[model samples]
Target: MGKPPLSGIRVVEFAGIGPGPFAGMMLADHGAEVIRIDRTRPGGLSLAIDAKDPLLRSRRSVSLDLKNPDAIAAVRRIVRDADAIIEGFRPGVMERLGLGPDVLLGDNPRLVYGRMTGWGQTGPRAHEPGHDINYVALSGVLHALGRAGEKPTPPINLAGDFGGGAMFLAFGMLAALLHAQRTGEGQVVDAAMTEGSSVLMSMMWGFRAMGRWRDERGTNLLDTAAHFYDTYETSDGKYVSLGAIEPQFYAEFRRVAGLDDAKWDRQMDQGGWPALKDELTALFRTRSRDEWVALFEGHDICFAPVLGFDEARADPHNVARGAFVEAGGVSQPAPAPRYSVSDTVVPQMAGARDDAGLLRELGFGDAEIAALGH
Candidate 1:
């Protein structure tokens, strides 16, 4: 196979939690040389960086005290040779540390400065402290989740943190990198979880605009209001998801599931959904999850067993596709979006790394490297 698409690119990551490291992981997985700037002393909300942490995989790390002027200079030198930088800090935090975009971008005109934050670089809430739940709550996503009369259920930070924040940061940085390559100019990518999460609801927003979606939680077609598109509990207490939205698929589901009642004929009758769903709930409970899986596995119905993390790892289809890989004695998801020629780099375990080699590559002399304690 050819080299990964990002084989020659270099990135300087100011490590933090959540989206920042995830974005760094994505870049490193694609074969970019990502050097992480870890703090000499653990501070703030930063978690303990462990070898088992998949997000911190595939990157070399350098420990530096940002409070020291020497460390700041070392970072500037590092950025001079970097193609991009990833930092997840609130507004003005990097400026206060003298590592803001203006200074770094001036040192390297083609540097893609990627910033990750909950509220973004501006707005009244920009400086406010927030988390994934808070960001998604403000994006109308949390309100749209859960049952009709129930309080909104948070999707455990996936929708806000990784999906909205990290994914957008990665996308923006790559886009800016392309622009920089073409025009020899760098730009700042301010990826806000709030804005990104809002963007994620574009389809729902379109449905609402077209009067096809209700503002109420769980009352919409795709939000569990439809009898043919929801999860059912089996006799063994395991769950399975059904997404037989199309007419033919739903018919196949009914036929395979033995739903011979005339009430199942009018598929789009939303008013009868609750009763039909209740009947399906009882019918599903008559069989075990495995039994249902065996019956629906090869059918036209869009059905799937709602497997837990461990089950997902051992699933036949996932195993066949090599979706999960063992790294650092931990089973985690593999790098995604397969390529025909370029091979994505396998993930490496995070651990202590000597910065001497990397510093020398960035043009640091022995004396300078010694001063930096490499």
Candidate 2:
């Protein structure tokens, strides 16, 4: 790929699960030179692993024990030239390693320090350990999901982890990088998953405050409470999602579904949602998912089949848009945003580029390279 947007950017990533690795991958995907510091035991290969985590791709890995003073010092040295340093751990982990943002920025005044935690850097729960589900639950996003009477369904790790942690961390780092570019000064971005998840609810919060949305589960317009917007099971035991909001779109949806005057008249009425959902479900079940898809294919009803990961890779629309690409015999979704002049890449392999090659390109001397000896 000819020079990506982040081609000249340098990032140092402290190895972490889910969100941290994902953030690193995003930066690397855009052509940032990302170096992942792994503390895992050396020498391991696994056939069970997916290799297409959508997280570990497009980066270089250096195994180092952060507990080691030399290793900590080495990390600082790496950050000395980095545009940004991102770490995801409980509150004190990096500070305990002696490579905290305060110390690193003291050394590299132009460095942007990005921190990701489940809670935050200074909240009462900051030092506590929690995962994506907990953060989302606390933020009320989880409760907003699922059927009206059903328990909240975890949307995997997407909401709190990727949406909150990785996305926010990437945004923070990039914003800080821009600031550093203009002023030659750096700043630290404290990105808490809780904070990000709350930010995600901004529109909902406004709705609730204005009495336009409800707190009850699955009752709000966006929460699948409306007949015009929700998922319905299909004949093949799979499903299809409908989001035919707005008067005209819902009118098209009504016409497509053969809705009568009663259904059309009270489309947005709170009292009619259950009847509407039942009617839609019955109509949807009469035909296969593909049949329904074909029926609504060209309309602006915001219709989509609820395709799984494998199905998505082979979908015609996705294929046409080049949304998924195969690399190293593995197929996964590609990096986003079609640039007019720049290239966006999917990292074909995790830890593929040589560490030695990256170091040399970054201007590391032989002695400096040698000092990172295992």
Candidate 3:
């Protein structure tokens, strides 16, 4: 077995909720040796057992008292040999703790400092606290994600938190790491959820600029406005999604779904979309979700049944692709983007290593590690 892509790359993650931990998970998933600096206390977080939180997997944990100077010095020692550090806090939180990027990067010139926040390090709202929903709401994503006349639906926290904040933070950190390796100068990566979510809306922004997209939700081509690219409820109340956007795919859809060619001819006629969607809705309800799945199984109509979380885990395609794996007696998504040269292994739970053991690995002596406080 080969080493993971990020093997030998050490990361010190200041334990945080949501995107910060998620970013660390991604790096650890890709073979980075991530050490999470957990707080000595619960710190108001729910702090579930590490086994249940898959995001905290693939990394080791070291509980520390940030208020203690000894603990702070111990972390500085860890950062001295680390390639990067990740934290999610308000603008001046790390600075107040004497662990800001400037100080860390000063000590280690090649450290990639990744900062994750909802509003970024600077700006009017930088110091304010906000969650995933609030971030996406500011990014114009929340306004564009619902039915025509209905209230805008929050697409959970996927868009703003994970996709925008965590993914971008990891990406930026890696990129900065590369640059640091080449130039011997590290930099700070300010990955804001609002900025990340806004970047995700780039395509929609272009469409809006070109007058090809409407400002209202559920009225755009890709926003469930088009009959050919929406979900319909099955007779069993399960739903199936369609994306027969092109002419060829739409033709296949018409044939397989047993649609009348004459009536469904004008696929892109905006005025007729509502009626066409109503017809599709009525037609789809005639069969069960499984029946629809069978009809479109091998076809190129871009269709699939909307399976629940349990259903998704047991899905044949997902099973075939090894999309999910069981680790620490928990079933969750496996490491993604498989490598050809380097193999990605199912990550083990990180809490297995005790704090002293983790510190010893970082070259700290037993006595020095003990003096850091519990």
Candidate 4:
């Protein structure tokens, strides 16, 4: 295979936290030369507790004191050769530092300026401080996460921080890069976690519009309401998930689960779901998760054991597909969305190489690199 699709792309990432580094990681994973401009000390926007955090993988780091005029000038010089720049900061922070879009883009019109934020650039809450939970809360995501009578459960930081913020920032940068490549005009990509969360609920919105979904939590088709589309605890305290949504799949599931009773015949009776779920709960509890897996392994039933991270990594199917790989002494998820013609590499832990040598490759002279590093 040839080099990764983004092999020749160059990115300059201003280290902040959360989604910014993740975006840069994605760029680097796909063969972009992502150079992270890290700070000398922890400040208001520090993202990682340790400099060796895995999210900073597949990149080189250059520590700079943005408050210093010389460092700021050096960053500008670096940006002149970059295809894109990523930063996750509150509005006007970059402008105040003299590295804002107008300043950088003035010198390099083809630069894709990617900005990551929880509330976006011009919202009423843009200036306020927030995190993943806060951002998803504003989008009704948190409210729809738990059981109908229970308090909403947060899905950690995945939904907002990585899903909404980081993924969107990466996508926006790629799209803007395409535009820059064609038009020679770069623009700011204001990726907001709140808006991205709302976008993720698009199908839910459609269901609500069609009266197929209610506003209450955990009462929808795919939200664990249906007896055939939820996770059930086994006798061994392990769990298995079912997604026998269609009639044919449900039939196969019923046959495999021995649900041949007259009560189970009324599969679409919404009023009987609670009773059906209770019966299934008891039935699933009679067998171990592995027993159920063996019973339905090669059948048409839509079933799978609810494996933990380690178990998932070792699963036969996942192992066969090469879904994960180890690098830099850590077993991490490999780069995704495989390409038939493009090649990708395992990422290394960031900050290992000499920043001076990396800067020299960027066209900086020996003295310039030393001065920048100091």
Off by over 4 Å in 4: 42-52, 351-353
Model 4, 156-198: lDDT tens digits are: 9988999988999999999999999899999999999999988
Worst 10 residues of 2 by lDDT: 41-50
Better of 1 and 4 by lDDT: 1
lDDT of 2 by residue, 140-250 (tens): 888887878899998898999999889998998999999999999999889888889889989999999999988888888888888888889998888999888888888
For model 3, how does the per-residue alpha-carbon lDDT over 80-99 read when each residue is reduced to its tens digit?
Answer: 99999999988999999999
RMSD of 2: 2.7
lDDT of each residue in 1-374, candidate 1, tens digit only: 99999999999999899999999999999999999998875442223579889999998888777887888999998899899999999999899999898999999999999999999999999999999999999988899999889999999999899999999999999999999999999999999999999999999999999999999988889999998899999999999999999999999998998888899998999899999999999999999999999989888999999999999999989999999999989899999878999999898898656677867877889998787655
Quote the lDDT for 173 in model 3: 96
Which lDDT value does model 3 have at 2?
A: 86
TM-score of each: 0.97, 0.92, 0.97, 0.96
Clashes of each: 0, 0, 0, 1
Cα deviation of 363 in candidate 1 (Å)? 3.2
RMSD of each: 1.9, 2.7, 1.8, 2.1
